[model samples]
Target chain A: MNGGLRHILLALLLLTGLNPAHAAEPIKIGSFLSVTGPASFLGDPELKTLQMVVDEVNARGGVLGRPVQLIHYDTGGNASDALRYVKRLIRRDRVDLIVGGTTTGDTLAVIPEVEREGVPLISLAGAIEIIEPVKKWVFKVAHTDRMAAAKIYEDLNRRGLTRVALITGDGGFDKSGREQLRQLAPEYGIQIVADESYGNRDTDITTQLTKIRASDAQALINFGFGQAPAIVTRNVAQLGIDLPLYQSHGVASQTFIDLAGPAAEGVRLPAAALVVAEQLPDDDPQKPVLLSYKNRYEAQHGPVSTFGGHAYDGIMIALAAVERAGGTDKAKVRDEIEKTQSFVGTSGIFNMTPEDHMGLSLDAFKMVEVREGVWTLVENAD
Target chain B: MLEQLFQFLVTGITVGSLYALVGLGFALIYNASDVVNFAQGEFVMLGAMTAISLVAVGFPLPLAAVAAILITIGVGLALERFAIEPSLGASVVTTIIITIGAAIFLRGVALLIWGKDFHALPAFSGDAPIHLGGATLLPQSLWVMGATVLLVVLVRAFLNKTLLGKALLACSVNRAAAQLVGINVRVMLRLAYGLSAGLGAIAGILIAPITFSSYEAGIMLGLKGFCAAIIGGMGNPMGAVAGGLLLGVLEALGAGLISSGYKDAITFLFVLMVLFFEPTGLFGHKSADRV
Candidate 1:
């Protein structure tokens, strides 16, 4: 009877042991993006890029020979929605890592949960505050608002335009850009002559444009994204203000020009090279990567924007760390991500260190002007 | 300072005219049926989007504008027949809720048809700013003001001079008496909806060149128009025009003289002050309670 009991215990152990060897577990990568709602323009393309890259990576025998499984949720451009999904992804889905947060508000909302859960999160938002205090487990991929303001200021300095008028929306991204532009103006030898703001629901801004027209500002700087920027362009033309208009990197897509019509001509903005990939010089390091991304994206989905490029950099960087760590262990993956250096991406060359989690500088931007409704590289403007 | 004042005045009148047109739409429907049609603003959206789509498909601008107005009338009539007619004898709150649902349904349909992008129509004339004493005016502003004046005159003539118009007004004053007097009060309600929708379409086409139109543009415009109707006193057409202009001018002047951040706040504050001083509204009549 004792021999029979020992054999039964051995059989149970064998059954459990054989289950592990039958199939290799897949590495799970979860994300929450603003796939619909007001910010869908940013998130829709991002979702497409993530799907494409994940498919390509898995086809090549994903990180450490384990297939990649992507779990995605749509945030619908709301902060509370992002938080709820992040919790589910951490607890229920049991994902190895997370890559998401298309907008700044969504990204900032998920940071606390991400830190407490001990999951490595690579964000795609443009807010500097996300990385400034540097939580141990959080990192970002998009060019920050500070970098955008610095890039615009550099171009303004080059053009010798000192007096600037600032117009911004009340959204978080616009607020951050406005703050950075105000703080960094004096250091760049720029003087703000007029500062104006408008609400998101406003139908007309002729009053604000009239004030800007009355100012001694030599250049008008608009720091808002979406349909509002188009209204500003139209208002500028309607008010007959002939000062040079400089937009922040927020209006970096063709939709802005399409809405503004002929009024978009001569408007300049600092944007990522992906906007004018075909116009880049041969020796530029980002040329090949931008072309490949642009071609692949446009082939699958009609056109590509810089917003999608942020997601590309995010997923690629996260996967690179996974490969470098040689496994899906969370602690080892976090360390490998911190040690990432000289990684070329569509946005810019990412050289991450413990001190600088963003790993991108002002050099990521290229000054481009809208010429006849298309982006034209402003030669030698840098 | 004078230049700033002139600039503010031009912008105020331009925007005020748009509000007036939308308010007129509210006033007409309120006069015929005791029910307030909350879907009035969606009429404007449909008008503008339909015209834009028609123009894109190679119709002449004038032809497209006319087509848009006709199509909007049909939609308004259909809304009355399907959504409003079935709820006859319902309470006021129920009718209002039904109209709100209609507005949401229209907005959703527009989203599926047009997608989520702001569309623009080229100005009827050149886009040159007319310089006047250091303040410039967009030609579209002139178009808006002119259209409002024309609409107000036509509506006034229709209400005061024509027998059919008088019959519609009779229905508003006493529906049971109008029906007893052979005025066909139900027909008057349908006519009122048709006219209000036509007015809304004209307003949409006129303002689309300036403000641009998207699927979500109607809600704020609808709310503001409702506020104007209240400020001018409900069921009064000319009062709606005055209320709309006052609201627009107040908003523009507040933005220019005080703070743009408080533009919306100032407008609502004025509305509240009016409600406190004159609960019936600036031009509202003092009617006895029915009960």
Candidate 2:
């Protein structure tokens, strides 16, 4: 081999060897989320928030006098990518803590690897499947789909709509949706009429809509993400179907409006307390925290905040726990997180327990309506 | 029950027309040049977005739609000349992979240029849901179905009747022979690609009113159309149409009778079963070797 090339190769190896020892000097945290993919809409916001919180903590004299170093990967919302990035973070990056990934499928897929590695893994998505088997190292910051559904049912019970038809995509979000809504329907005096489900990639749902139109339902509840909800909105409008559409929190974005046009107006749904804090006045209790986070995030990144709030909450709690631990010991940090009590978060007051990795409950669901391209709070606290 | 059945059929036919149009474009390219242009979906996306942009800028419907189709045709010819001809005589799978890579590149370019916002192509007719015999159908959907049927007939006539079309088919069958027969096979290849892109652009424009336009919307639509082509065989125009319509019906039935959750699964399963059991396809000729 040439002398210059040989020297370069040796230097690279030496740098690689010195990198991990370098990583340990700074309290390292890893983040993996869908910076690109179907769930990128959710992951992008979370990533923005994660970077924001990391910056904030570092500026405030990071935990234990060591600034937190964040290593991140884009999982692309693929389970295989999650496994790959998990391996990369643990084996290569040598991160002390791991946070993120915004989809149920990816989070659940990586549970086995997280356990095998024994690194503290906190999920940004809650599919109910992630925390149930209870791996020693796994914790989740997002509320489970079941809890979200339960909250919706309780809130809608008082609403005059008795029969509701569903239009949902056949995806991971739809799975928990069917289970939770089906079981919770009778409890709320709501009957599911003419429910329709389309594929995750299906572009049209006219057949489902026609059936939905013929039904005696007074309202439509959509459970899906992105284009699915938007497609439904446009289709319903094009078909001249006038039923009020209540969408899953997954549809909380301008993406729907961009796709659905004027059809997006007046749609009702449940969302995180923070994202729609615009509906709450300046004097509202939740306004200050949400606005501050939103402003800081927009200034740092752009105007997108979904998993950003969850991630911000996740990092804050994780850092708080690390401080309570007085060190980066995994168990002590976990213990401190478990004892989180009424900790005001972008979503709600999170009070996590050892038994429950997800601190917030169904009570976190806040009813909101889209009016003139803006999401407004609908007062329905069941 | 009857209402649900009606709804499912309307949904199936509207979406099926789009798949058929896209599959027909694939068939045209495959038949003429023996190349599967997997970037057919990008043409569709480009058409939709182009039309949407023009409409957003207050252009007339006919002008925007025509511009979209012409632009796509230009893109197709450009791609065939630069990418396909250079890699001519390559293996089928290699061409397919190249096209897939091209699809990714096109998607990235679209994102970089237009951003990742979903946009709707305004319906030519005003938004009024028309009820036809207990079934509600959108006006845009009627236009799509009408356009699809028209394209099918137009394609059949053009391929069977036109001298250029005959020359193109002759090239597909025997390029060297066609060249000896005083046919410019290179021009035929360009013609095939341009026509394919034109047809896909039409589908993109026709369906944009309902499906809306986005940079990445073409990915799933392309996959579904490709699956339809698989069911129909790669090169047969009739098979492509039949396969598209059949898959649409199957998806509708799956959505209506069975769990709506398994619609795509059923369509994929149908494709798999056909490939496994009847590799020649429902109506396609043995254009290539199978095994």
Which candidate comes out best when scored by TM-score? 1
User: What tens-digit string does per-residue lDDT give for candidate 2 at A1-382?
Assistant: 3566445534544655654344325778988898788787788788878877888888886766568989999998898989899899989998877888788888887888878877778888968778886667788877677776766665566666678887777777876887778888887787887777877667777767766777788888888886778878877876678887788887776667667777788887778877687767677665677888888888866665556788988888888887666556666676787788877778777877777777777667687877888778888533
Provide the DockQ value for model 1. Answer: 0.64
| lDDT by residue (tens digit), candidate 1, B1-291 | 888888998888878888988888998888777677899999999999999999999999999999999999999999988988888767889999999999999999998888777788888997887888877778888898888888888887888799998888787677788899999876888899899999888889988988788887788778888888889988778888889999999988999999988888999999999889988779876655311
What TM-score does each model's chain B reach against the true chain B? 0.96, 0.95
Model 1: residue A364 alpha-carbon error in angstroms: 0.9
Interface RMSD of 1: 1.4
Worst lDDT 10-window in candidate 2 chain A: A15-24
Give me the runs in candidate 1 sitting further than 4 Å from their true place: A1-26, A55-67, B170-186, B288-291
Model 2 has a DockQ score of 0.51
Q: How close is candidate 1 to the true structure, as a TM-score?
A: 0.91
- Give a tens-digit lDDT track for model 1, residues A1-382: 2565445434544655645342346779999999877787788889999999989888886656567889999999999999999999999999999999999899899999999989999999998889989889999999988888888888888888899999998888889999999999989999999999987667778898888888999999999887788889988998888999989788898888887888899999989989998998899999999999999999998779898999999999999998777667799899999988988899999999999998987778888999988999997764
